[model samples]
Target: MRIFVPGDAAAIALGADDVAQAIQNAAARRGLPVEIVRNGSRGMVWLEPLVEAETPAGRIAYGPVEPAAVSGLFEAGFFEGGAHPLRIGRPEDHPFLKRQTRLAFARCGITDPLSLDDYRAHGGLKGLERALAIGPAATVEEVVNSGLRGRGGAGFPTGIKWRTVAETKAQQKYIVCNADEGDSGTFADRMMMEGDPFCLIEGMAIAGIATGATKGYIYIRSEYPHAVAAMREAVRRARKAGFLGERLPGSTHSFDMEVRVGAGAYVCGEETALLDSLEGKRGQVRAKPPLPAHVGLFGKPTVINNVISLASVPFILAEGGAAYRDFGMGRSRGTMPIQLAGNIKHGGLFETAFGITLGELVDDIGGGTASGRPVKAVQVGGPLGAYFPRALFGTPFDYEAFAAADGLIGHGGIVVFDDTVNMLEQARFAFEFCAFESCGKCTPCRIGSKRGAETIDKIRGGIDPGANLALVQELCETMKFGSLCALGGFTPYPVLSAIRHFPEDFGTAAHLAAAE
Candidate 1:
C-alpha cells in the first residue's frame, strides 16, 4: 500500500508531521505493508495534512487529518480506498483543484520534491534536455515566442529580458532569481521552492544557456527556512546527477547555481535592490536607466527574473512557446498562479489562464468569505496592490485589465476582505507597513510614509476630517509619483483604492462608527 503526506512547510505547521507519524504507527500496528511518501502540498491549504492513499481507481484523499484520526481512518479501510468521513475523493475533482490550468505547478504536490527519479517520472528536465538539443539561440526564440511576462509584479516580457542579456557582451553574465517574496498576501515563491526545487534549478539552467550565463543565484527571503533547506538539498542532488554543475549531459555548455538568503526586507523584492542585497550590501532600490540587463551584480550584464517567471521557462521550452501563448487573453498570455488568501473560504493556490474575472476567483473558486459575511473588498497583488470593491469584480485578471481599473495583478495574490472590515483602517495599515518596511533610501518614501500614517491617524481622530481626506490624497499622489521604489510608489494603491471605493469607512470617528 502507498500513502502520501505533504512535507511542505504549510502542511507541517498544521500538524502534518504528527499525522504522518500516526499513519506509520497505525500501519505497523495493523501489520500491513505500507510505503509512506512525503510529497509537497497540492496548494489546497485549508485542506492540508491531506493524506492520499493510492488505489487502482486513483489517489484517494483525506484532508485536515489529525494524529488522533489515524486509527479511525485505517478502520474505515482508507488503504483500500474505503469511504470515510474525511474522504474528499480524488482531490483533482474538488472544485478548488479542478478549476486550475496548472502549467508551472504541474509537478507540484504530485511528486516527492527531493526525489530526482520522481521528477523525471513526472516529465522533469525535459525542457533543459530540449534546450541542450536545440542550442541557445533557438531556445531563446522559443521563450520569446511564448507570451510569458514577468510574474514578479512588473509583468515585463521574460523573453525580451533574456534577449537583452543574451545580446549584451560580458565576460561574466549572471542569472539572478528573485525569491524574496515579501508581499503580504504572497506565498507562491516559498511554496514553489519547497514543493519543486528542481523545477527552479532546471529553469535557471535553461536561463544560463539562453543568456550565456554560467552562474546563477536564487535570492530567497530569510523567512522561508524550509525553502532554503529544500533548495540546498535539490541543488546537491542535481549536481550529483549531472543535471547541474560544470557541464551538461549531452552538450558542451556548463552552468552552476547557489541559493542566497535575503535579510527579509520588502524592498529586496525589487530586482535592483535584490542585486545590492546579493552583493553583501544593504538592500536599497537602484535607479533604472542602466537596467539590470546592461549593468548589474558587480557591474556585469545580468538576467534577473522572479521565481515564477524562471520556473515557467522549462515548460515553454518543452511544450513550445506557442502552446503557452495560446492560454490567456489579450496581452496577458499564459497561465497565472493566482494565490487566494485572507477571508476566503477555500483559500489556496489557483493556477489558471489569465482573463478569469476577479469575481470568479473570489466567489466561485474561493467560495466567498470564510466568515460568511459579504465580501467588501478584494486586494489584488500584494499589500501595495489596489483594493477592488464589489462593483469592479468583473475586472479580468490581466496586467492591462487591472491597470485599466487603477489596480495591478502584481504577483497574482488576491486578499479578500469581508464587510466587517474598515477600509480606512486598511489604508492606514498600508502606510504603516510602508513606513516600517521602507529601505529609507529616498526622501519621498522615508518622510512621506511617516507623514501619510500621521495624516490617516488625524482623520481617524476627528481632526478636520474634510481637509485630512484631501491631504491624504495629496500625500498618496506624491508617494505614487515621487517615491524611489515600489515600497512607496505602490503604497498609494491600497490607500487611494480604499478612499475611492469605500468612502464611508474614512473620515471622522463618528462617521466610522455610523458605518459600523
Candidate 2:
C-alpha cells in the first residue's frame, strides 16, 4: 500500500509530521506493508495533513487528519479508500481543486519533490528539452509571445524583460529568481519552491539558456528554511542529473545555479534591492534608468523574475507559448496561483485563469469569511495592496482590471476580512508595516511611512480630524509618487483605498468633517 503525506511547510505546521508518524505506527500495529511517500501539498491548506491512500481507483484523500484519528482511519479501512468522516475522496474531485487550471502547479503535491524521475514522468524537463531544440533566440521569442508578466506585484511583461536581457551584449549575463516572497498572506512562491523545486529549477535553467547566462541565483528569503533546503537539494540533484552544471542535457550552452538566502528584509523583495542584497550589500532600492536587465548583479546584464514568472516558463516552453497564453483574459494571459488567506473559510492556493472576478474568488471559491459573517473587505495584494470593499468585488483578477480598480495583484495574495474588521486599523497596519520594513534608502519611504502611521493615530484620536485626514492623504500622494521602491510607493495603496472605501471606520469625526 502507498500512502502520501504532505511535506509542505503549511502541512507540517498543521501537524502533518505527527500524522505521518501516526500513519506509520498504525500500519505497524496492523502489520500491513505500507510505503509512506512525503509529497508536496495539494494546496488545500484547510484540509492539511491531507493524507492520500493509493487504492485501485486512484489516490483517495483524507484530510485535516490528526494523529489520534490515524487509528480510527485504519479501523475504518482507510487504506482501501475508507468510509471515514475525514475522507475527502479524490483530491482533484474536490470543488476547490476542480475549479483550478493547475498548469504550473500540476506536478506539485503529486510527486516526490526530490525525485528527478518523478519530475520527468510528470512533464518536467520537457520545457528544457524544447528550449534546447528551439535554441535560445526562439525560447526568448516563445516567452515573448506567451504574454507572461512578472507575478511579483509589478505587471511588467516577462517576455520584454527576457528579450532585453537576451539582446543585451554582455560578457557574463545572469538570471536571478526573486524568491524573497515577503508579501503578507502570500505563500505561492514558497509553495512552488517547497512543493516542486524542479519546476523553479527548470524555469531558471530555461532563463539562463535563453538569456545566454551561464549562472543563475535563487534569492529566497531566510524565513523559508524549508524552501531553502528543498531548493538546495533539488539543485544538487539537478546538477548530478546533468540538468544543470557545465552543460544541460543534449545542449552545448552551460548554466548553473545556487540558492542564496536573504537577510529577511521585506524591502529586498524589490528587484534592485534583491540584487543589492545578493551582491553582499545592504538591501536598498536602486533608481531605475539603467534597469536590472542592463546593469544588475555585479553590473552585468540580468533577467530578474518572480518565482511564478520563471516557473510558468517550463509550461510555456513545453506546450508552446500560445498554449499558455490561451488560458487567461486579455493582456493578463495565462493562469495565476491565487492565494486565499486571512478570514476566508476555504483558504488555500487557487491557480486559475486571470479573468475570475473578485466576488467569485472571495465568495464562491473562498467560501466567504471564516467568521461566518459577511466579508467587509478584501486586500488583493500584499500588505501594501489596496483594501477593496464589497462594492469593488466585481473587479476581475487581471492586472489592468485591478489597476483600474486602484489595486494590484501583488503576488496574487487575497486576504479577506469580515464585518468586524476595522478598516482604520487595517490602514494603520499597512503604514506600520511599511514603516517597519522600509530600507531607509529614500526619505519619502523612510520618513513618510512613520509620519503616515502617526497621522492615522491622530485621526483615530479625533484630534483635528479634518486637517489630519487631509494631511494623511497628502502624505500618501507624496509617498505614492516620490518613494524610491515599492516598499514606500505601494504603501499608500491600502491607506488611501481604505479611506476611499471605508470612510466610516476612519472615525465619524473625520467622515463628518470631510463631508463639510
Candidate 3:
C-alpha cells in the first residue's frame, strides 16, 4: 500500500509530519506493508495533513488527523478503506476543492513532484512537447488564445508578455521567475515550488522555448527552506532525465535553469529590484519604460514572471488555450489560485475561477472568523492590499473587480480579521511596513512613508484629529502617485482602506479618556 501526505510548510505546521509518522506506526502495528510518500497538498488546504491510502478504487483520503488516532485508524482496517471520522468520502466531493478552478495548480497535490515520469503521465511536459512539436510562434499564439494572465499581483496577460519578449531582439534573453514572495498571507509560490516543482520548471522551459530565451532562473527567497531544497532536488532529477540542461527532449532548443536565493528583502519581489538582487547589488526599484521585457537581467531582454504564471503554461499548452479561456469570466480568463490565511477559521490555499464572491469565500468556505465573532474586515492580496468590509463581500474575485473595490488580487492572498480587531492599528502598521521596506530609490516613498506613520500617530493622539486625518490622506496620495514602485504605490491601499471602512478604530486613546 502507498500513502501520500502533503509536505508543504503549511501542512508541516499543521503537523503533517506527525500524521505521516502515525500512518507508519499504524501500519507497523497492523502488520500491513505500507510505503508512505510526502507529496504536496491537493491545495484543498482545509483538508490538510490530508492523508491518502492508495487502493484499487482510488486514493482513499483522510485528513486533519491527530497522532492519538493512529491505533484506532489501524484497528478499523484503514488500510482496507474502513469508515473513518476524518474521511470526507471522496476528496473531490468537498465543496472547497470541488468549486476551485485549478490551472497553475492542476498537477499540484496529484503527482509526485520529483518524479519526471509521474509528471509526464499526468499531462506534464505536454506544453513543452507540443511547443517543440510546433514552432515558437504557434506556442505564443496558443498562450494568447488561452487568455492566461500573471497570477501575480498585476494580472498581466501571459500571452502578450511572451509575445513582447519574443519580439525583442537580444543576444542574451533570460526567463526570470520572481519567487520572492514577501507577502504575509501569500504562499502559493512556496507551495507550488515545493509541491509541484516540475510544473514551474516546465513552465519556465516553455517560456524559454516561446521567447527564445536559452536560460532561466527562479529567484526564491531564503525563508522557504523546504522549497529551496525541493527545487534543487527537482532540478537534479530533471537534468538527469534530460528535461533540463543543453538539448531538451532532443529538441534544437537549448535552455538552462538555476535557483538563486535572496536574503530577507521585500523590495526584491519587484522585477527591477529582483534584477538588482540577482546582480548581487542592494535590492532597489528601477524606472520603467525600458521595461524588463525590453531591457532586463544584466541589460538583456528578460521575461520576469511569477511562479503561478510560469506554472500555468503547461496546462495551457496541453489543454489548449480555448479550453482555459472557457473557465474565466470576462477578461479575467482561466482559474486563479486564491490563498486564505490569518484570522479565518479555515486558513489555506483555495484555487478557483475568477468569479466567486468574497462573501462566499469568507462566509461559506472560510466558515467565518476563527474567534467566532463577526468578521470586521478582510484584507485581500497582501498587507498592501485594501480592506473590504462585509458590505463589499459580494464583489467578485476578479482583478478588475478587486481594482474597482480599491483593492488588489495580489497573489490572491486573503487574510481575514474579526470584529475584535482594530483597523486603525492595522492601517498604521501598513504605513510603518511601507516605511521600513521602501527601496529608497524615490523620495516620496522613502520620506513620505515615514511621515505617513507619524501623521497617523498624531491622529491617534487626538491632536488636531481632523486636520491630521486630512494630512495622512494627502501624504498617502503623494506616496501613491509619486513613489517609484509597488512597495510605495500600494502602501496607500491599506491605509486608505482602513480609514474608509473603519473610521472608529483610528480614534485616539485620548478620545476614549475624554468620553469616559
Top model by TM-score, which number? Answer: 2
Candidate 2 has its poorest 10 consecutive residues by lDDT at 507-516
| Pairwise lDDT winner, candidates 1 and 2 | 2
Separately for all candidates shown, the number of backbone clashes (residues 3 or more apart, or on different chains) is 0, 0, 2
Models 1 onward score TM values of: 0.98, 0.99, 0.96
lDDT digits (tens) for residues 1-516 of candidate 3? 888878888788888999888888777876878888788887766667788777776777887766786677776667666788887656667777787777788778877878888888887888889988887999999999998888778888889988999999988899999999999889999989988999999999999999999999999999999899999999889988888888888688988899999999899998899999998899998899899899999989899999998998888888899888998788898888888888888777788888999998888988998889989999999978999989999999888988988999898999998888888788889988987888888998888888888988888777888778878888888889988888899999999998887777866543443355
Kindly report which residue stretches of model 2 are placed more than 4 angstroms away from their true locations once superposed. 513-516
- The stretch of ten residues in a row with the least summed lDDT in candidate 1 is 507-516
Instruction: Supply the global lDDT for candidate 2.
Output: 0.93
**Between 1 and 2, whose TM-score is larger?**
2
Q: How much is 495 displaced in model 3, in angstroms?
A: 0.5
Q: Give the alpha carbon lDDT tens digit for every residue of 1-516 in model 1.
A: 989999889999999999999999988999998999889899999999999999998999998899999999999999988889999999889878887898999989999999999999999999999999999899989999998999999999999999999999989999999999988788888888989999999999999999999999999999999999999999999999998888889888899898999877888998999999999999988998799999999889999999999999999999999999999999999999999999999888999999999999999999999999999999999999999999999999999999999999999999999999999899999999999988888988898889999999988888888788888889888999998888899999999889888888885533553455
Sorted on TM-score, best first, the list reads 2, 1, 3
Every candidate's lDDT:
0.92, 0.93, 0.86
Regions of candidate 3 where Cα sits further than 4 Å from its true position: 508-516
lDDT at 481, model 2: 93
